[model samples]
Target: MNIGVIKETKTDETRVALQPFQVKVLIANGHKIYVENNAGVLAGFPDDEYVVNGAEIKDKKYILDKCKLILKIKAPLDNEYNDYTKDHIIFTYLHFDENILPDKIRELIKSGFMGIAYEWVEESGRYPLLEPMSKLTGYLFAQKAVEFCTKYKGIICGKHEDYLKGANVLIIGLGTIGLSSLKFCMDNNLKISVLDKNLATVNIRINERFKTNKIDYIEKYSIELISFNNSDPLKTKAELEKTINKYDIILNCAVRRPDMPKDKLEYLIDRQMIQTMEPYSVICDTTACDNDLIETCVSSEEVDKIDIINDVVHYSCDHLPSIVGKSATELLTSQTFPFILEIANKGISEAVKSNKALYRGVVCYKNKITHRYIAEKKGFQFYKLSDLV
Candidate 1:
């Protein structure tokens, strides 16, 4: 098996799909590993390190032309589209549902390469490959919340005895990202409240954590659980309005599928709700999609530049993990290397057929759309992998 690690071409994307250590492991397993020159440089892994670890350093053209299995931190850019062949198996974060261009999607279909999306690779209903990055994003969101509050509003985000009250934070989801943000907020002595589409699941997680004596902060501070109707955005907005103004920071980690209808995709926090909030309040959307849960979050912004709508600061960076390339790449490779090894050893056809997680990750296989969600959203014909395999 020949595996190629391509340098990420996305702007501000510094993480590499494989580190030097992983490359060494792959080579030891009797697989040929080709790394693009400076592929891992931004992630603190140099070309010399890869060379020392038995990886052949090659240019992008050589890698794409010779390697059948391609690994990347991001999807192939427009310039790289023409380089792909039907035999190529690209494993990366191919976010087809999110603001991807129609032409790019069509190009992928036309190329007939198998696209195994890292974010969709699931085990026991959890996204193992995506979890590390999500946790990193949560930490970044919390840090940004503190910075925005202090810089824009001239108020400390954390609680202090001298102050009458600490900053109030509303976490809009209780998934991996939300829980991580909650842990950080608790450590910082911020008043925290949480809400999720499934309150029952949220209660179970809280109760389980409390029983294990893991979350002592929950005992010290009353963590309120707010509920809202996910089906009706207007009603949810109305419910939030009663107390939305009181919150100093709002971290929206909730997810909205791209295939959802426009009517069902109304903003959880509309402009009218933003007008009710205090000046300089921070709203960080961890999901980071345009016209997502936060109405004011028109588009993803750079970490340094934030959008100000109705005096509230909106922080939404789509690739927060990229900013912390070293840690993010290390954590990402730990989970992804195993899957890559599986595909390398067993081959794509055998690997996808044998590994359900890998099969689920396949958005495109055998020149057809294997993922129903993406196919339906893009108005393309859907083909099941089982039928094609």
Candidate 2:
């Protein structure tokens, strides 16, 4: 079976779909790989590298239409691609941002080529190939969030010649992204405060990996408890109020809530309780895309409100894990390449027979929607790819 690598035409996208070293892995497995010219330039892979690795630099046509599998980091632009048939498999990061599905994603699904989203693999929690990038986004957000909080709040965290020191960072979840952020924060010697609804589950799954707070946000930091999934926001006008100065940066890596619960927002902004800080106190809510989260954050209502006091979000932030381009590509590549190589060697049939990486549409073979959020968007029926298998 032929595997194709296409140019990543997305504007300002520095990472390539396939790096030179990765192509050689496929070739070593006796698979044919066709790459578009200069596909890996930005990632530091020269044209000579691909040639040495035995991948053919070919025109887009044979690589797209003829190959049984297509690998890319971006969604295929509809106008540039050939017909998408049921037999084809396109593996990519299918970003879902808004209520309105982007034309690129709608077209990919309409193209009807068995679409496998690395991002959605986590939605099922069975095969989590995409966690590394999720980890990447979370880690970077934590580091940058500290800067946003200090600068906004008017607190000086580090010296000109030194790295950030003794920052107070709050990580809301314990997933890979959350864990990565926590680790990054600790490595920088920042004070960390962890909050979560479920102590049991978080401890069981994340504690061992994170070393059970061995990283220590406590000696120099403060901790708080809150529930998000099962209970309504606590009307703790006072308990939460006490938590005010205890924290400097709140880095939310949890699920998005476009607008947060009204009570939650009220707790955040009560002037006498919080506005007393040096003024750069900030909340870098990655969950801002969620209507529940955005609608709830008082910061969005008045970016100046915090800026006036000194807390500000210094850099533009997003769920676009791609911004940490080279790191994202390398981590995502190392984590996902093994499965692609398996599929290449055995073909989809034997490849997926026992392998969890195989997914058809949104459904797992178990007959469940791997991504309920995406299904909710377009009213598309989800079948379990596992059951079908």
Candidate 3:
């Protein structure tokens, strides 16, 4: 098996798909590893390190032409589209749900490569590959929230007793990203409240995680839990209007379903709701898109670029993990290496047939769209991998 690690071409994307250590392991397992020249440089793993670890350091063109399997941090850019063939297997964060454009999706299908999206690969109802980066993104978002509030709002976020007045933070959703943000807010002694669709379940999880015997700090802390119903936007909006103005910061980590109808989608926080927020208050949307949970959030800004809407600071950088390249690459590659090794050893056909998680990750295989959600969302014909194989 011949595998190639390509340099990420996305703007501000610094993470590499495979680390030097992983390259060494793959080579030891009777697999040939070819890393693009300087592929891991931005992530602190130099080409020399890969060469030392038994990986051939070659240019992108040479590696793409030679290797059948391609490992990447991001999907192939427009310029690299022509280089792919039906024989290639691209394993990366394809982001067909949102980040990727229609033309790119079309190109991917036309190219007939087996496209395995890292974010879609799941095990035990968890996205194993996506979780690490999600956690990292949440941690970075919390740090950015603090920085944005202090810089733009001119106030420190801390406990009221130690400071003049504490900042109130409202975290939307209770997923990995939201919980990570909540932990950071709790450590900073900010008045924290949580909003989720199922408040009771969230309460149970929170209580279980912060048991009195385990954690003393959160034992006495009483967090207000708010319920949100996405189906009833008007009701949710009315309920939020009552207290939306009180929070100094709002972190939206809730994800919108990719197959959701555009007409049916409603903003969780509209312009009017944002208007109620105090001047200079910050809203950070971790799950950022064009029509995100936060109406003002657009994924166009570069890392750390703040947008001001109605005097409220909005921080929504889609690739927050990319900013912390070294940590992200190390965490991401560790999880993805095992899957890569499986494919390398067993071949794509055998690997996908044997591993359900790997099969679920395949969005496009055998010149057809294999993922139902992606197929429906993109209006493409969907085919089962079993049928295709």
Candidate 4:
């Protein structure tokens, strides 16, 4: 397979999909890698190093056209989308459900290319390529949330700016992303309130014997800190509204695709609207499909919510791992090394069969999209992997 690596075109994207050392591993497995010049520059993997590691140093356009498989940190922006082909297998944290997928992405899916999403590929409960960045995004979201909260008045900060001492912060969701935010938020010694839709999960948190309690109080106090499930949106919204008014910051760690409840949520949002809560109120979501967050950043000639919430910031809807530069690259290597080997030596078919990979097209060879989320979005069903087998 002619594996290709391209410099990410998504604004603020400093991470590369393939690091030099990782490329060398694939190369040793009889796979050819074509990397764009300076592809890994932001990640500290210079073009010279790629050449030294036996990767072909090619231009962006050249590799995209010729490679059998492609690795990208972000969905292609407009310009790059026009040149995308149909035969390449594109791999990355594709936020397709968010509808933030660029037009180029639609073209790639329609072109019948093999698309593998790192975020969806879970192995032994770990998201292979996306774990590192997800962890970073969760941590970074808290830091940025603190910055955004300063716009509001009277957020409990002890001594300096960035030090959030005694503030009410709510992180909804206890997944990888949520826990990550909780770690940073707790480290800052802030009062936290968390929520998830799982009742069983609620028991796990409040259950004093939840283990790991000796080390972290956030886990200990989570039970007592006021948590709720999504059983009742109106009541939940009211409870959340009260907390939002009381807290200094709100970090939305939930990973829900925001398409299903437009009217209901809009109505609830209106009911819970608390503009009088000062201008410094910060709301940050590390969730991928931040449609509401994106909606918060717009305006129009006729009607707009432009000035609705001030000082509120959405975690860079773009990939945040890229912002940390080389650290992001090192993290990418940690993620891609295993997957690259599986693809090079064993083939994508085997990888997907192992339930450790997510595929794009020809899901069942029954002519239907196979991935559950994609199928849900496109109104298709999960065809049997065995049918393809």
The clash count for each model shown is: 0, 46, 0, 3
Estimate, for each residue in 1-389, the C-alpha lDDT of model 2 and write its tens digit: 79987777765565666777888888888888888787777776777888898889887766777798888886555565445566677777655533334454555555456666766654355446567766676776776676565555555543223564455666776667777877777566666666665755654555566566543344333444454433444453345456756667766666634354455443333445545444556666554343333223432322122223334332324434556567767877786787688778888767655565464223322222345556555455655454554
State the weakest 10-residue window (summed lDDT) of model 1: 209-218
TM-score of each: 0.92, 0.73, 0.93, 0.80
lDDT per residue, candidate 4, 299-339, as tens digits? 12111011335444334344556668799778777866677
Candidate 3 structure, TM-score to reference: 0.93
Query: CA shift at 64, candidate 1, in angstroms?
Result: 0.7
Candidate 4: global Cα-lDDT? 0.62
Descending-lDDT candidate ranking: 3, 1, 4, 2
Kindly state the number of residue pairs that clash in model 1: 0
**Whole-model lDDT, model 1:** 0.84
Of the two candidates 3 and 4, the one with more favorable lDDT, higher being better, is 3
* RMSD after CA superposition, every candidate: 2.3, 5.9, 2.3, 5.1
Q: Give the per-residue lDDT of model 1 (tens digit) for 101-175.
A: 666788865878889999899889989999899888888889888888989988887885755478899999888
The per-residue C-alpha lDDT of model 1 at residue 270 equals 81
Best-matching candidate per TM-score = 3
